[model samples]
Target: MAKKKTNEPKTLKPEIAVGVLGSGSFATAIVKMLVENSKTVHWCVRNEFVKGAIELRHHNPTYLTSVSFAPKSIKVTTDINELVSQCEIIVLATPSIYLSDQMEKMTCEYRDKIFVSAIKGIVPKANDVVAHYLRDNFEIGFRNQAVIAGPCHAEEVAMERLSYLTIATVEDEVSEKLCQLFSSSFIKVEPSKDILGNEYSAILKNIYAIGAGIAGGLGYGDNFTAVFVSNAIREMEIFLEAIYEAPRDVNESAYLGDLLVTAYSLFSRNRNLGNLIGKGYTVKSAIQSMNMIAEGYYAADSIYRTSKEKGMKTPIIDTIYGILYEEKNAEKQFKKLTAKLT
Candidate 1:
């Protein structure tokens, strides 16, 4: 696998078929971005209802409504086998909870094709990152694929906001290929070898985002938030030290940048759910109102569970799980979390 030079412009093939494994906002946004950039994409939607919705409306009305696609521009399917057979590059955009089930049914003929994982959480049952799941299940080598993590918001792409993502892989060829595949006028791609570190940082930020939102919901001032986010970074670093080689700029665009944005941004359902919890809504109520899967909600369980099994300290993740799932008081949990941080 050859390493590609960063920021060096290279020609891209005009006709590339990208397969998207989920019909969620992230998947829709990525596929739509490719088409808007004139790249062909195939997407899999499991239910007949969603397939019909996309065909009739030209958009995934349930997940991402602001962006629409032409019926002929993107191939939308209910059949997983068909999607796998046709795609050159497969993007697993499904949420972490559903990832295992989706992978179980998928049989890829293109073992040599690039597998681009846009999923951002640890798989709960296996406690595995997306890349590891692909490798163990698909028997693909490091050079066969890449993972994209970032501060990117799928909603922003609906407004065509310029965003950046970090592509990390041990194999230089996979990283470079992913960088080229996802790069467009609106999407900027940077490559790194710190795949594990990047994934951990990306996952931890969600837990912290819930904390920030709780603070916001409680009417806490910026002074509190600044300290909170700083400790959040420290906690992330402490965890990553054991699991990864330490990535450059985890506090920058891909890691901390994502944390800041997701923790406070209007587009974050995780933050929103935290806000509701802080405001005294039950987890069930918040989830019902949001009508979405906040990966952070699920990640709290995975994070806390994995940390417990690994003998790692994760007060932030535990605090979040307590509030969202255990029905703990948000203010008390915030206090406990802050005390631990200090």
Candidate 2:
């Protein structure tokens, strides 16, 4: 069932040291948000070059270069162990594929801290969502975890465009406190308790975005694209219900709004991957051409595997999985897909 929200005031934790564990675009955006309400953030970066750039230039050299930081707003490091030890709230913002390797160095002490998952993809090897992966590996409890999700993109946040984020957690106090850290004049925060629903929605939207890109590459008109997206949302609602069995509406920003933006936005890497495939690039060639990780590529296998195990019928996911993993001809598979959509 959808949880009810009351008019009670949000509780803010004072002097909470928040640490971020990524150097990507989204991680930079998150740091930008947190620093507004914080004096210092403990950030761990894998690349020593990125660490140097942020320390010396106060700007991320690779990702969001235009977004600058203040003189002492961030405390950057290469040590994950050190970062987690200093902060009470640990935000995991690394790409899903690299998460296991990046966090292998950290100690188990972080299991007691509040974990916020900013990765939109599942952990590839384990086929588990970030929260679930952490719970199993690090022994972190669900109440200690929260996820930041929505239609908001890292590029938009870097531009200081008005954006909204949904922070999902099991505890109201966890959500309430984390919202204070993420809220800014340009950034608004919404709290949700539907962690699984929100996380799965984020993962699924990337796959559908790839479908959108493929359609564009194949010379499908806007009329066809519009219909494709409409059917995609209904499919998303069904997938969510089958997986989580919740009474929540999938039309909210965390679900439908997120799916819309990722599927059509120019900044979508998942769509970019699909576009390359649709343009006759081999899957390997298309992936190699992209500068960033396309979460959809890694998530397709996991979500598809899970769906089959549960005996649920998800045509869009199945089609995308067939094209991506099975190396089925994109044109031929999409032609079949076109017949399935309403």
Candidate 3:
């Protein structure tokens, strides 16, 4: 069940110190945003070479090398505890699969700090969203938790292209402060109170994007792709409503806009994974080939289990799960899925 929103407001300072945990493309992009508004940003990068490169070269060596940073404005460290102790807010951008392991390494208590999940998938074994995971394990209350959702992509952020980010928290002050930290000339931040809805929408969209890629790889043209995505949004609405009944517009950018971009954008890693699978690569081979994580690959199973337990009807999720996890033929599953979609 979703936690009830509290009437008690949380306090946020004007000058906020931010820390980001993760060294991926999105993490690099987020650090870039922080540097624009912050004097110094604390970042946790476990990789020695990546840490050395960022400190010495003023750029991430592995991801998003094109976007350079002022080395003096950022503090790169190998210790999660050190970073956590130094910063007021910690943005968790690590892959959801690795979230547990990463949290286990934290020597400091996270209960007092604000945690924002930039990760969009459920934690693997726990089957809980990032917010719930923190709440259950670390006693981080919903009041102190927030989520960053996007119809936006890290690649576009790296290019300094215009993008929209939805920052969701039950506390208005927390959302506003995060918006101030992240908003730039090109990056527009919108505040939302629907944290769970937006987080689930963000997770569900990647699964739909994989379905879109499967269709594209199977030679289904724009006409079919359009129908697939339209039905996908409806399915996402049903799933979100079933899980957490909120007065949210599924048509909002955080929900519908996010689904559209992930399903159609060239930068979508989930779509790329499905495309490879559709073109005859086995799931193992497809996963092996990509350097970045295709979140949907992990999210599919988690969504499938949760929706099943909830007794919700999610045809799009079911179909994608069958193709990706059940090893069902992609062509056959999509054909069956077409009949279910309007």
Candidate 4:
């Protein structure tokens, strides 16, 4: 018996077509992983030059220059709305400071699509994580949203080195789909149920990494750094438990692993910014010199303001905020900060 073909459309997996937004190292790395699985990655950078360069040169002229793209592997554009319309999953890798300006250009409804935030910082002014921001503004419920946390760095990913990624989502199907999209010979994917915890851990770790860099800049040795990081993880675990009581392991790669890498890695821009600040460059000067966004710089202020509202005691966060925002002396502030840490 021959099976008859009907006028029916074939159903695809929910997030097979993935779109990426941003023009940074992390965003490029994401497209790298997606290319391994997806036929064509729909990517939206900020402007025409970036779009043209990548399409013409088979490489991003801005970041991750060594990683070339296959011809026709990436469908690059400057229009966010167009990218969203064609893809089932959208990965936001833009820095937090620029997210609002980029998102403002959007005119499409996105609640039906799966959104994965690779951003590790909170949206400024809103003083809220991207999950909440998307929920409030875009009407995308938590179920359709996910987060990508790294212990894995994009530089390492570009090298094809072994790396691990933690994908956090409340929905099991999302985790499964995202896992398949990113899994490769060099990458290992782990799914987590504590989405909020992973997101906050990602944010807080960068702040602590800055503090670690400050300590290094001030000539503090590895001994002090070890203690500082230990306390940072404890602080992160406490904050996570206070907000959401779930069966989450703080020692897992998503939380503590991400913290340690950002704190110590040479590639961490947040720590580099703090090092410059601790070495006596003004926050303004440190930021201007870097030419990259150190998310912790913005996150510190937002977290401090939000914590005050929630009645949370985040001494590390407060200390960093004071140095970065209030123009407090870094040396004096950190001296006072040490007494609060065990």
Candidate 5:
């Protein structure tokens, strides 16, 4: 069963320090959002070079260039130890593949702070989501000051378009506090207690986005695309049942909203990667052509490996894996998948 929202109000502030774990577009956009709202943010980059670029240029020239920033007003740090110690809220915005390595360098003192994960991918090595890593490695709890920020795009922040996010946590107090802490003029925040379904829905939708792109790449029209997304929802329903109660909101904004945008938007690396696969390009060529990170490629292996280990049937995930890494042709794989359902 799902938990209900409480009506208690708490202190909302404009000056809380937020620490982000990556120098990527999403991280930069998050920091920009907080700063625009009058909160201070400290972004953690790997080296002095990326750190210098963001600090000096006021823009992430490498990852999110179109969006300019004036974060000279905030702090930027390269040291992970120093970052975790200073912030009230810690945001993990790194890719899923780099999460374990990043976690190894941080201390458990962050257990007292609130954790907000802006990443959305399944880790292949550990077969776990970003929140699971924080909980298992740092000993964080489900109901204790942890939340998942899902289906938010960094590019939209560059346009200053009004965007919405679902901050999922089990603790009522933490959820209520975060909804205010992260809310801003251009960024609206929605709170939910179903942390489990929120993250899973976000991850699984990316996999489906790749599938949708592959369909588009194959010259499939709106009729086929309609069937594709509908079946994908059924796929999501089966997958979400394993871990969480059905969240209608998950299918509404964060889940389906992200699915449509990423599947069709030119800004989506996952869709671009899928288009390359449909065009007979190898995974190496696809990734090399693009300079951004596509969570679906890494997540494909994670879902495949973990689902196999857990004995879960994920046909869409399996078909995507086959096209990218298994040397299966896209047309052949599509027919195979269609045959199974028919």
Candidate 6:
């Protein structure tokens, strides 16, 4: 018995079929991007109504409604197996919390398919990132796995605003092909082999965005935010080095740029979640109010537990976990955080 060589490139034709799994704003945006390059995309919409709306109305009824699609270009279905069987490449855009259940619904094989994770949070109960979850549970190899990370937001993508995306995979050809598939006049695609670093950075940035939003909601001005973000990146660098130790640039768009956008952008759901909490809403209440999933809310506990077990001192992560999970006062937790930041 021999182990499979995961890096051996599989033949990806120029006319490869693509599928997007999820019906959220980001998923809608990704479908939009794919249609620009590929002829038809197999889309799995879990909600029958949303699937109907997309197929019949040519737009997502709930998210990114402004961006219309050609009905002929999208093959919309509620069945995950239907979509998986129809496509060679699958982009997972589901909320991390729902991912395991969604993956469980697939009865088809995934070993031959190329999976790109657009998810930025850890899987809740499993405490694994999407890439590892695919490997551990589905036996999908690293070469078959890729990640789509943003400094880019869905709203901006819908508006056709110029944005940057980093496509990361251990296999160079996989990363390059994805980059080619996803790039457009308004979208710039960069390639990287640092899949772990990029994915971890994507997850961590959302948690830090919550910290920024809390500061904003608490009436802290630009001066405090500037210092807070600066400290956040340093904290991110230390944590990544301690865990993965990859020779990667922390200042790249996939790292620092993603952090900046999530922390400061108006479209950030994680920041919005923190704002509600900072304005004195209970965690349960704030979560109930939003229609979207805030990755930071889930990532906080997962990162905290993992960091503690690994014996990494993450004061910012600790402060956020206390404020969110331990029921600590936001003002006091942030006050303590201020002392540790400089």
lDDT of 1 by residue, 164-197 (tens): 9888777775665566667877889888777777
Alpha-carbon deviation at 226 in model 5, angstroms? 1.9
Which of candidates 2 and 3 reaches a greater lDDT?
Answer: 3
In candidate 6, what are the lDDT values of residues 257-317, reduced to their tens digit?
Answer: 9999999998999999999988998888988999999999999998998889999888989
Task: State the weakest 10-residue window (summed lDDT) of model 1.
Answer: 7-16
Q: How many clashes in each candidate?
A: 0, 0, 0, 0, 0, 0
CA lDDT, candidate 4, residue 68: 96
Candidate 4: worst-modelled 10 consecutive residues by lDDT: 6-15
Q: Compute the lDDT of residue 19 as modeled in candidate 3.
A: 96
- Model 4, range 1-342, lDDT digits (tens) per residue? 978967443234443989999999999999998888777899999899998899889989988899999988899999999999898899999988778788878888776899999999999856788888888877888899999996978899899888899999888888988998998888899998777888888998999999999999988899999999998998888788777789988899999899989999999999999999999999999999997899998888877777777788888888999999999999999999989989
Question: How accurate locally is residue 239 in candidate 6, as Cα lDDT from 0 to 100?
Answer: 86
Error of 1 at 220 (Å): 1.7
The digit string of per-residue lDDT tens for model 2 on 1-342 reads 977866543344366789999999999989988888888888998778889988899999999899999869999998988998899998999999889997788764776789899999999767899878988888888889998889888999999898989999999888877988888888989889888899999999999999999888878879988998898889888888888887778888999889989988999999999999888898899999999999999999999998899887788899989989998998988899989988
Models, CA RMSD each: 4.5, 5.1, 6.7, 4.2, 5.5, 6.5
Clashes of 2: 0
Error of 4 at 322 (Å): 0.9
Model 4 ranges off by over 4 Å:
1-15
lDDT tens digits, residue span 1-342, model 3: 988966533233356989999998888889988887888899998678889988889999988889998878899997899889998899998888877888898888667788999999989868888888888888888999999997888889999999999999998878878987998888899889998999999999999999899899888999999999998998899999998999999998899999999999999999999999888788889899999999998999999999999999999899989988898998888888888888
- Residue 135, candidate 5: Cα error in Å is 1.6
lDDT of 3 at 330: 88
lDDT of 5 by residue, 89-160 (tens): 788888877777777888647777887877888755567886676677678777554555555678887678
Compute each candidate's TM-score over C-alphas: 0.89, 0.95, 0.95, 0.94, 0.90, 0.95
Q: Which 10 residues in a row give candidate 5 its minimum summed lDDT?
A: 5-14
Candidate 2: C-alpha RMSD after superposition: 5.1
lDDT of 4 at 40: 88
